[model samples]
Target: MRTTALLFSLSISFGSLAQLQPIAADVYRWKDLKIEKEQTRERRQVLEGSARDLDLLEIHTSALEPGKSPHPPHTHDDVEELVIVKEGNLRVTIKGQSKILGPGSVALAIPGEEHGFENGGNTRVTYYIIKYRSKLPMNIDRGKQAGGSFMIDRSELTVKTTDKGSRINYFERPTSMAQRFEMHVTTLNAGMNSHPPHTHRAEEIVLLISGSGKIQIGEQHKDASVGDLIFLGSEVLHAFTNTGQEPCSYFAFQWN
Candidate 1:
């Protein structure tokens, strides 16, 4: 491909030199995303990887028929993908190993790993894939990393207390194979919030799993319900509150 100055800039920004960060703060209601159809499956793009957003981070949700695969097992040269099952049983295949991850389960696919998945049950399966290429080196040495795809089931999430609620830490570079992120599931009781509105240097994505809630970004506020993927960019003050009668839960993953 012919390289333009803009393209060159992007290359440098995504090349192990923290030159750019993907995506500024934003929020996406699942119902608002338009699905793109394919022969074997369909997907909705929530965030596209671009120089303006950050160098190479993307967010999308996909659904497949009971017996279909999104594609054959494959590998990316530089992108690491996180698959979070939203519904049904998703059979993920990495290399020659395979496992069926249920709803709320998380699967990791590092760059250079052969990975793909399909709905192995009788019903359709919906899931979200967060793929990104980290420009910054991890705090841990790469040679010490245990690289491969693995599943973290929802049943395994250990609940711990927070000031107003509780949470479960699922993945992080220090304990997981990923070099760029940490993910957690937090729950807030009805009409409660963990804290006041705040902002941070890291970018994050919050996907609601259950109950009713509200997310405030800057001066604007919106309802947070099941199936919504809310994106909060660096330095954009945001906060949340459970608006429903039951506890609200969500999966939150952020990168430095």
Candidate 2:
């Protein structure tokens, strides 16, 4: 009887451990630029599953064709949406105003607001989308039935580039629980470097989107190519330099 009881207890413990195992990461690639015209784009990458799923969901290096856009103006009562333009141009309509978002531009749409997007340039528009989730389940379709409209005029967004070649654009500040920061890096024609060695309160993850560069974190530095990802811990001094013939472009996000 003693032996049987011991085996049963061990089995229960093992079952509980299995349930606590983490979820795997899932990556979705973009095959085309036009599929659903009314909502969603053709060229877009989506990351889902346990690894990508956190308090926030981020879409990186997303490319949208000229005629395609995401879902109609909709509000999430429990989540905040952030958009950052990396390349090309886009028209973003929020409430009743339209703004143009060019490379290095960032915008934030609070929860319960109406928003939409449309590509304005001839080339594909690439941008990053970050959605912050609440502890409770988000009602994405909220306010659709009332007189409140979910669609925003595509002509309301204005486009402008920052003078600081490549600089950090933050949508959400770092908090004790979960924080997100994003930035765009544009190398100069003759190649330049970012300095003054700075550290912050959150960890950082970088994604190289265009051109080539080298990232120096603490005493370690390495060459980075397109699609390369680098992770740095909090309070780690880091900087980057443009090392390629053409201008190098990249995006980074810091999470706390």
Candidate 3:
């Protein structure tokens, strides 16, 4: 009877695993906009994953062709956006300051802040966009006629930034996870194609979407490839580098 029970458990586990689906590629392609005179060609929006249970939304990969631009300067009064560059370079205009972001770099645009982007480089630009909405909206309009107004209050929102090897571009109040704080990860490739050695107040998990490198977490420094995941604890000095011929790209989520 014990053996039969064990076999049944194994079957259930396999069934659960089989039910999981990878992030769809078609979702990454942004097709709602018309191609104009701009040099931009390709555009897509891929929904990587989301944790509805934890109020977390993850947009795995988004690409913009050379000379293409996203929406004009806009703001989400209640949602916090974290963007991480995967390949090529992107020019971000935040409050009129234009900065070129390369692979492994990240930026955070606060609610009510004017922000937008353009593929300022010759290569295609891909990046990860994560959105944390305190209150999920009842309707989502993907068309151009949809109202561009925000429904939440901006003064009540709080924001913060931290610098690890990859920068913690922006953060709000920490979410409580088993008595620990939680923050979104926004890793950028800046110095020497990698980040510096530093620790943080919360634990973190990393997912590599592009480039190649090694992740040093505590004493375990392991090779990182596309689709690799790394977990880190609070106060653990972690770092990463671009070990491949091209640039490295990844995102880290910190949860205490």
Candidate that scores best on lDDT? 1
What does candidate 1's lDDT look like per residue over 56-124, in tens digits?
777888899998998888988666778999999999988778888898899887666689898989999
lDDT of 2 by residue, 1-256 (tens): 9999999999998676445422221112233223333235643444421222244443434567886676566766655666767678877888867776777566666567778888878888877676655333543343232223222222343323444353443333432223333343443332777555678765555666677777787777777776555555557788878788886666666543
Query: Once superposed on the true structure, which residue ranges of model 1 sit more than 4 Å away at CA?
Result: 1-24, 51-53, 137-148, 161-163, 174-180
Candidate 1: lDDT of 102? 90
Candidate 3 has an lDDT of: 0.54
Q: Give the better candidate number (1 or 3) by lDDT.
A: 1
Candidate 2 TM-score, C-alpha based: 0.54
Over 4 Å off, model 2: 1-40, 43-54, 133-200, 205-210, 216-222, 226-239, 245-256
Error of 2 at 238 (Å): 4.6
Better of 1 and 2 by lDDT: 1
Local distance difference test scores for all models? 0.79, 0.56, 0.54
Residue 233's C-alpha lDDT in candidate 1?
Answer: 76
Among the numbered candidates, top TM-score falls to 1
Candidate 1, RMSD to the unseen true structure: 4.6
| Winner on lDDT (2 vs 3) | 2
Q: TM-scores across all candidates?
A: 0.84, 0.54, 0.45
Clash count list over all predictions? 6, 10, 11
